[model samples]
Target: MKKRAIQILLALSLIFYKSTWFWRVFNHLAKPYLPASREFFQILLLMESGVLFLAVIY
Candidate 1:
Protein backbone atom coordinates (compact mmCIF):
# COMPACT_ATOMS: atom_id res chain seq x y z
CA MET A 1 0.00 0.00 0.00
CA LYS A 2 2.78 2.42 0.76
CA LYS A 3 4.49 1.69 -2.55
CA ARG A 4 1.19 2.20 -4.41
CA ALA A 5 0.62 5.53 -2.71
CA ILE A 6 4.12 6.65 -3.57
CA GLN A 7 3.64 5.66 -7.18
CA ILE A 8 0.38 7.58 -7.40
CA LEU A 9 2.00 10.62 -5.87
CA LEU A 10 4.88 10.43 -8.30
CA ALA A 11 2.52 10.05 -11.25
CA LEU A 12 0.51 13.10 -10.23
CA SER A 13 3.65 15.12 -9.70
CA LEU A 14 4.99 14.12 -13.11
CA ILE A 15 1.75 15.06 -14.84
CA PHE A 16 1.61 18.41 -13.15
CA TYR A 17 5.27 19.14 -13.87
CA LYS A 18 4.94 18.20 -17.53
CA SER A 19 1.78 20.26 -18.00
CA THR A 20 3.42 23.28 -16.40
CA TRP A 21 6.50 22.85 -18.59
CA PHE A 22 4.36 22.55 -21.72
CA TRP A 23 2.42 25.68 -20.85
CA ARG A 24 5.60 27.61 -20.18
CA VAL A 25 6.89 26.69 -23.62
CA PHE A 26 3.54 27.56 -25.16
CA ASN A 27 3.42 30.89 -23.36
CA HIS A 28 6.90 31.72 -24.53
CA LEU A 29 5.92 31.02 -28.11
CA ALA A 30 2.75 33.05 -27.76
CA LYS A 31 4.30 35.90 -25.82
CA PRO A 32 4.49 38.14 -28.84
CA TYR A 33 0.70 38.07 -29.29
CA LEU A 34 0.00 38.48 -25.59
CA PRO A 35 -0.30 41.86 -23.94
CA ALA A 36 3.01 43.21 -22.67
CA SER A 37 1.81 46.58 -21.41
CA ARG A 38 2.17 47.63 -17.78
CA GLU A 39 -1.43 48.84 -17.80
CA PHE A 40 -2.56 45.37 -18.77
CA PHE A 41 -0.89 43.81 -15.74
CA GLN A 42 -2.24 46.52 -13.47
CA ILE A 43 -5.75 45.89 -14.70
CA LEU A 44 -5.33 42.18 -14.15
CA LEU A 45 -4.12 42.76 -10.62
CA LEU A 46 -7.03 45.04 -9.82
CA MET A 47 -9.49 42.55 -11.26
CA GLU A 48 -8.06 39.67 -9.20
CA SER A 49 -8.01 41.79 -6.06
CA GLY A 50 -11.62 42.76 -6.50
CA VAL A 51 -12.61 39.15 -7.05
CA LEU A 52 -10.78 38.00 -3.94
CA PHE A 53 -12.28 40.79 -1.85
CA LEU A 54 -15.76 39.93 -3.02
CA ALA A 55 -15.13 36.25 -2.33
CA VAL A 56 -14.06 36.95 1.23
CA ILE A 57 -17.02 39.20 1.91
CA TYR A 58 -19.63 36.91 0.44
Candidate 2:
Protein backbone atom coordinates (compact mmCIF):
# COMPACT_ATOMS: atom_id res chain seq x y z
CA MET A 1 0.00 0.00 0.00
CA LYS A 2 2.79 2.42 0.82
CA LYS A 3 4.61 1.71 -2.39
CA ARG A 4 1.42 2.12 -4.36
CA ALA A 5 0.80 5.50 -2.77
CA ILE A 6 4.30 6.67 -3.66
CA GLN A 7 3.89 5.45 -7.20
CA ILE A 8 0.61 7.27 -7.61
CA LEU A 9 2.12 10.50 -6.34
CA LEU A 10 5.06 10.16 -8.69
CA ALA A 11 2.82 9.48 -11.64
CA LEU A 12 0.71 12.51 -10.85
CA SER A 13 3.77 14.73 -10.62
CA LEU A 14 5.06 13.47 -13.91
CA ILE A 15 1.77 14.13 -15.58
CA PHE A 16 1.81 17.69 -14.24
CA TYR A 17 5.32 18.29 -15.53
CA LYS A 18 4.54 16.85 -18.95
CA SER A 19 1.38 18.87 -19.29
CA THR A 20 2.94 22.19 -18.32
CA TRP A 21 4.80 22.84 -21.58
CA PHE A 22 2.02 21.46 -23.74
CA TRP A 23 -0.49 23.59 -21.93
CA ARG A 24 1.51 26.76 -22.55
CA VAL A 25 1.72 25.97 -26.27
CA PHE A 26 -1.90 25.03 -26.38
CA ASN A 27 -2.87 28.34 -24.87
CA HIS A 28 -0.83 30.29 -27.36
CA LEU A 29 -1.81 28.37 -30.48
CA ALA A 30 -5.40 27.63 -29.59
CA LYS A 31 -6.68 31.19 -29.91
CA PRO A 32 -7.45 30.61 -33.57
CA TYR A 33 -9.12 27.28 -32.74
CA LEU A 34 -11.45 27.80 -29.82
CA PRO A 35 -12.89 24.33 -30.05
CA ALA A 36 -9.51 22.70 -29.84
CA SER A 37 -8.62 24.90 -26.90
CA ARG A 38 -11.70 23.78 -25.07
CA GLU A 39 -10.92 20.17 -25.81
CA PHE A 40 -7.38 20.54 -24.61
CA PHE A 41 -8.51 22.14 -21.37
CA GLN A 42 -11.07 19.39 -20.88
CA ILE A 43 -8.45 16.70 -21.30
CA LEU A 44 -6.11 18.43 -18.88
CA LEU A 45 -8.89 18.81 -16.34
CA LEU A 46 -9.79 15.16 -16.68
CA MET A 47 -6.20 14.10 -16.12
CA GLU A 48 -6.00 16.31 -13.04
CA SER A 49 -9.25 14.86 -11.78
CA GLY A 50 -7.88 11.37 -12.21
CA VAL A 51 -4.79 12.32 -10.25
CA LEU A 52 -6.91 13.69 -7.44
CA PHE A 53 -9.01 10.55 -7.41
CA LEU A 54 -5.95 8.39 -7.20
CA ALA A 55 -4.60 10.46 -4.33
CA VAL A 56 -7.85 10.04 -2.45
CA ILE A 57 -8.29 6.37 -3.15
CA TYR A 58 -4.73 5.32 -2.59
Model 1: lDDT equals 0.60
Q: Candidate 2 lDDT, tens digit per residue, 1-58?
A: 9987877787777777767866788778887868556786867778786867676665
Supply the TM-score for candidate 1.
0.50
1-58 per-residue lDDT for model 1 (tens digits): 7876666666556655755665577567767876565356556655755654455444
Question: Top lDDT: which candidate number?
Answer: 2
Candidate closest to the true structure, highest TM-score: 2
Model 2's TM-score against the true structure: 0.54
Q: Which regions in candidate 2 have their CA more than 4 angstroms from the true location?
A: 39-41, 44-58
User: All models: lDDT?
Assistant: 0.60, 0.74
Q: What is the lDDT of residue 23 in candidate 2?
A: 70
Give each model a TM-score: 0.50, 0.54
RMSD of each: 9.8, 4.1
